[model samples]
Target: MEKSAVYHRPSDNFAYSINKTTLQIRLRTKKADVQNVKLLFGDPYIWENNEWQIEEMPMTLSGSDDVFDYWQVYVSPAFKRLRYGFKLQSDADTLIYTEKGFYETAPLDTDFYFCIPYLHQNEVFDAPDWVKNTVWYQIFPERFANGDSSLDPKDTKPWGSEKPAVNNFFGGDFAGIIQHLDYLVDLGINGIYFTPVFKAYSNHKYDTIDYMEIDPQFGDKETLKRLIAECHSRGIKVMLDAVFNHSGYYFPPFQDVLEKGEQSPYKEWFHPHSFPLTGGERPNYDAFGFVESMPKLNTANPEVKDYLLTVGKYWIEEFNIDGWRLDVANEIDHQFWREFRQEVRSIKSDLYILGEIWHDSMAWLRGDQFDGVMNYPFTTNIKNLLAKQSITGQEFIENMSKVYHNYPKNVFEVTFNLVGSHDTPRILTECEDDEQRTKLIYTILLTFMGTPCLYYGDEIGMSGGADPGCRECMKWNEEDQNLDMKQHIQRLINLRTNERLLANDGEIEFLLPDSPNGIFGYRKYTEDKSIVVLVNSTDTEKSYSFTEPLSDIKDIYSGKTYTGSSVTLEGYGFAILNY
Candidate 1:
């Protein structure tokens, strides 16, 4: 046995309480190394006559990646406490594992076992339950719509008349969003995640000039409140984007530094490499990448921390916003985020806190910092397989397996899954204008675990590249829109909201077929029913044979009933089969 490859922890993703009583535990071993694993667990205090009451339960192989196979088991301790260990039997050796280390023999002492002294309900990773059931719509405030022409920027141009540029604005405002509430409601989206709407000089609003005020072009504080109220009246939730990692060059504190240099009282508010502030080809201090206009905030400073925390509290307490989508969240300090969570949750305990992190985020998702991060890895992997066709079905499963086991079940449920965003190319364009391929990807996204978000105009078959190109004006004219694509996405949204098995709580299992080319499949199942999603990502038609008898199969998309064991799909085809 390759014992060195084995890994487990008593807390976090490896083990966590799914509810008040039920605890889920996971173990990782080298791929194809262990033949079997049995969990040995019992309450630490449950001892009688100098013997601890223990029970042994076999663990099932849940998933695998390139290097590891993950095993999982669920346990509910009668006494609300747990002391557990694992017994592994491999082809070459047998061993016992615990919190301390691997042991040659099973130790009778409870101290040697992994411990969950008592499962405190408060420590549980509790994000809002509503978030898991939501379908989010991400709106770039500057490009969504223009309701009030009076609020248009001085240089505002005609909407959709020209391609987007770095310094151009199309007069999209809060009134525009308010004007389109019915449209969004018709599309069946319950949550709206708006990119930074605060006062900023740039069109995207990432560089924050004032965190307290909404951008003039986007409307004032009152306008935002009205928008939020309107959304709430229709059962929709509002989440505003916050950029606290840095301040724009025109921000008061940053401007003070530039004007008075070291003499300014707010000198410590930012990071300055030298006595005099300098901004040229590169910043003399820390900033967001190479942009000197956005000076990095000194979050460690007490004053700066207090100011940011106030900003975090203001939206939830004053405006009654549902959540905050933090920009460049990975760049901020852990302590600041912990305090931010405490302050914000103090007002609204159920408010969702999502981070804009593009990579591995296990550190920020331990039930303390963030409810979940933007699931960019999910986006990348899906793009590689479905859009680019660079990976096989088995490889996609392996990649997803790694992500599946990276966090506790609660965190995974709230993950922000998206195929395209303000930062990426449109989904249809990524699929080379192939509507079938785009629909297939959306099917997987909508049916998979986590909350799914759709970029504005994606449902109408809008196509563009990244950045300036992706931020196109919303096409409201039916003549300019693709009605078929819009209807397809609307149907998906309805299915996701109305179906119980499609919700975040469903158990998902990826089916790895023997054939590696063009086909990928998985099933979202519960004790009462199951839904299988299969997709063929190639140009040519494909055939798949079921490993077991699939009885009473009905495709939700096509309403085609199948009683056979095998099925065939047309080019770039897919199916959502219910059994």
Candidate 2:
């Protein structure tokens, strides 16, 4: 409360630094109920198809105070702008605790997130507020659109085929995005969040091979310059997805360890004893994650921290990019993120940092590391409830309301909410292909609190089953889009950008139904106006008597007037009203 007693550096002057890619932490807080402060680092692994993949972080609290604080935990080889945060331990709240020990979410959604320090404050971090009051579109760099036919991969597979497979690249490149700037600007998207564009072997580029260079496939520096210049002229900001949690085996250091045993000078860059004694093979590393192709970089190494930090800052200076979306953000060392936020602000005070967080990230949102986090808790929760057909109207209201109260008020307004991203099935498909239900999903995303992001093709009625299936090429066809999907999305974006009441101020409440049926309702208002969104999750149309607060608004979508005591909604129906 009252912003809490915190000492923070001037946003303009702060920067995170690493010297040896090694670090030590000493606890500074006076509290003694100290269990162990777990030092965790890795990418925020995307949870899909019910699989969990994590990049392991080596812990070195090792009782050394000389290198770090008595409680100062250290990990290294950190990049200047890597995403990281802390997880603290106290006997008081046994439920859940991250470095700062705060959580906010609802039963409406079970997904949660850890808070980080890179959160841009409300002008507090000296970073100019993000071009707030704008719209964002998330583009999977490889699939959105291939503007240059020459750039299309010669070995690409057909989308959705079982043989060649969905994992194959579709040749979407930065130049492709540059070519479509006109299309996107016309659609009213002011910000673009491209999935990881760093050098990697795969189409997704999560296995970062080099942080400094944009993958040659994406385009060279010249292409990026033109794209950045054109986008800036058009008022569009490009945010690249930066993956810092691990490096591919092809990464120089990883390969060095493979080629030369203890003689390798870079041996300390990874988990100790991670390399095998024979053939200098790393049969495995301590990094207990999904696979070995992606070797977890020892962020605890001071040298590693310093190297990444320098690279992150370089991008801002080299290219006038707007910001970054940290991939697998949860797994990176906390020290790395703290230092990164400090440094990046110094480089470009206006940059925005978004983290890939699945859980309640309120702790990370506390005037620190990230300006906002991808709201998976809200996204997946809504998807699962709708898919299972068990979501209640009251449950919906209560769940979202909890989100409203979960994060710090100042930064909460800017969090990103979306119905689907590249990693999940399209919202329409996720909800069992029901057009009306997907419309309800639309209401939840565009009208709810925070900035809403629409996946590249979802607005045009793109459909798929799951992860690889959800990520498909953009449909240039205006007719194939289901139910005027593009137009509907345009309306939603217009509402978010144009309506002050809907943008920030809103009241979320559950209309407790007589039975346990699923029906959720929420309202947004300001001094001069109000907007209401009501959805029915059950098969049958739901009805309820009108009440004082809700009876006042008119349905903007249908121009229906409501008065008196009871109001009724058709089955699988939703109403958006304004008054």
Candidate 3:
């Protein structure tokens, strides 16, 4: 037995309250090392004599990655607390694993077991339920459309007439978005995540000049309210970007600090290292990555916190927005986010709070701060697997399994999953303009767990590199768009909307292949039904045989019926099977 590989903890993803009464505990062991595991658990106080009474529940092998096999079991303690340990059996030896150390036999003292101090209902990760069913469409407002050319900024070019640049503007407004609400509806998008729409100096609007006012380039507050009403009327949800991390140089408060230095009442709102602030190769004061124009706000300040909290609540209270995607969320203090979540959610109990974090965000997702992060790890793995072709199918499955096990099931369900975004290269560009590979990427995205988001022009096969290149004007002409790609994504969204299992409804078990580059897939199943999604990343045709015989199997994508244990797919092909 590999004693070093056996691991468990009594908090976070390992042991967490799934609901008011149920506690789900998980254990990890080296891959293929352990033959079986049984969870020995009981209330800490439930003891008849001095023996410490307990019950044994066999832990099921939930999933496995490259290095570890994860096992899980759900138990409800009568006393709302638990003391648990594991009895792990390998081919050669059996050992009892607990908080203390490996023991030859189960220990009677509860002190040796891991403890879940108490299971409070509030501790259960609770995100907006509507998020799971949503399919998000991200829009860079300046490039989406030019509905009213009258609202165009000075020197605004004709829509899609030229390439995009950091300073260029094409006058995309709420009127433009409102004009195309039906287009998104046809694509089966239920949620729209617009990049910063607040008044700012830059075209991207990340540097907030005014949090309370809508950028004139995007139209007035009434126009935004009308857009929200139109979206809600059509069964769509609106999520606005909140750039509270920093303020633009042109912002009134920031300009005052730059002018007054120490005498400015708002000087403490920012992080100024010394008097006489100057901007050059590096700013004299702390800023967002030494950029003089974008100054990081000191969120720890009471006045700054109050102002931001008001900005957070004003949108929900006034415009009835459904969500807020926090910018630079990881850099901010956790206490502010806790208060942000409380303040915003108090007004709208179901308002979704998403954070823009590109890495592991377990620290911010403990039911106290963010409901979910941007899920950049999932994006990196997918891009490497299908787009870059740097990783094989087996490696992709293993990598994704690690991402899946990093967070609680509920947190993963509502994560903001995306492939191409305003910050990354477009999916088609990432796949080197190959429509087939792009289609496969969308297949994995829309069919996988969590709410998937499609970048503004991705469905129509728009291709561009990172940053300014990715923020092109939306193609309005059907002749200019890739109809096939659009149809393919539209169908996938339909399947996701109609089928509950596809959208975080059941447990997912990844199917690992023998060879590193071989065919691979995952099975999302419940007690009554199952869905097996297979992907063939190679150029030649590939076949995958199911371990168990499948009867009355139907391909959800093609609507073809077949009864068999094996299935074949062409190069870059995917199958969504239902039986």
Candidate 4:
């Protein structure tokens, strides 16, 4: 009926803008019989020229794959969604199974619609008047706090085996987080972003073991319901991390396939590969689809989708959460997400769905996949700019402008900006204990457009070098630490949360001084307010002067009064002004 799906990719769904420059194309299928597949395109519909005809751009895969089967095709780093597909020479004809063929993702899917009709209010892409005003705090549940020691992992636990390393087990349970919601409230965080609480094997819980049950070590579902209720009472909403990309090899159904082979009833739930290769002959299959401990699940399996949707809906229907922070998001099927986002809306129309994509939230922000993504590039750019010492203040502003221009208004308005996350060293350590510079980074994170995120212990000056190491327990004691760090953080956060002009809307720029190498300076303000941040990145003190009148803000810390643009800042100093 549709020319036998002349392309093996969802080419029809491929839509992008040249302003972003790059794009991506994704294809997923379990059939291992197809070989020597190559994608060819006639031409991209560049400029609706009243006709579709042009010489297409040609490209090839970076590596070789001769009939290799992938467990999943969650697109990684392929920036733009390209219009291309597989060309496999089948027996009678070289069949082209299109990605978003009419048989698969119908064009009627208005979720994939363009700008005007695709704001996705139901998916929280359409930010309400309330969302723009709230701040969020992300906590990996098991590492946050240990409120109930009684709930600690038992020897040879029922759900899964226990490991002894800090990551293996920390005994952090629901009661622990329940006990600390107030601490978050005190810190002025209006929302909580937690890692999964679902039953799983590893401590991180990325690989789900039991969909219906909560890990005993993490407390039962009742505890979760209570925590949600309590958080609501405190005016704080909860956003649970969603990690459905893959399941642990030991996950029940998958284990059934492992133990019973093709005879297993649930065997259809996964992409079959060389199984149970005992005798240690290197049992074949990409773990995490590419890593062995994390075998990818088949979200395309009707049963898998039905079961997972129920799990997702349960969280919203039961606990009334605000949204979801999808883990390893780019690794999911686009068709599946279109439905997933739709199903989530059936329960609650305005639930936020932020993907954990490092590259571009704009990739999926077309309104079909996710509302937002972790602004990794945003933070990483500044860090690289600082470390390389190659970028100037103006360069930083241009990069940010590029980011903002790529996404729709709402996404750019509510992105999550952070200095450090659970995966990296504390910003304090990255700054090498330069309290003044650390405070400047902190200042920029909040004063910028996105919703600022504070890693659990970063505010108190907790430092770690890398992964696992970055996840240290919270330290409450303030004695002997840099009092300046604590006070400075408090001031910045207060400004972000309480200042009317500083919260969401504002003009931002990095003001370069005459001595270009001397400082990293920026200014942010709306019609109602204005603040300037001048950072002396170097260590040795260097004095400098401002050229114009500066009277918009009363320096909260220095207790200084000024009404002239010509002012000066001390070395390593940052400022916040309201003008």
The clash count for each model shown is 0, 85, 0, 26
| Candidate 2 wrong stretches, greater than 4 Å | 1-128, 157-167, 277-283, 286-288, 506-515, 549-552
lDDT (CA) for every model shown? Answer: 0.90, 0.63, 0.91, 0.62
How far does residue 547 in candidate 3 sit from its true spot (Å)?
1.8
Cand. 2 Cα-lDDT: 0.63
Please tell me which predicted candidate would have the highest lDDT against the true structure.
3
Clash pairs, candidate 3, are: none
Rank by TM-score (best first): 3, 1, 2, 4
- Model 1 ranges off by over 4 Å: 91-93, 103-105
**How high is each candidate's TM-score?**
0.97, 0.74, 0.98, 0.73
Model 1 global lDDT (CA atoms, 0 to 1): 0.90
> Which ten residues in a row are the worst by lDDT in model 2?
1-10
Candidate 3 — which residues are off by over 4 angstroms? none
> Lowest summed lDDT over 10 consecutive residues: which window, candidate 3?
559-568
Q: In model 4, what lDDT does residue 488 have?
A: 72
Candidate 3, residues 19-76: lDDT per residue as tens digits? 8989888999999999999999888887896778989999989888889999998899
Q: Encode model 4's per-residue lDDT on 41-65: one tens digit a residue.
A: 3223332545332222323221112
Candidate 3's TM-score: 0.98
Model 4 residue 372 CA deviation (Å) reads 0.9
Selected candidate, larger lDDT, 2 vs 3: 3
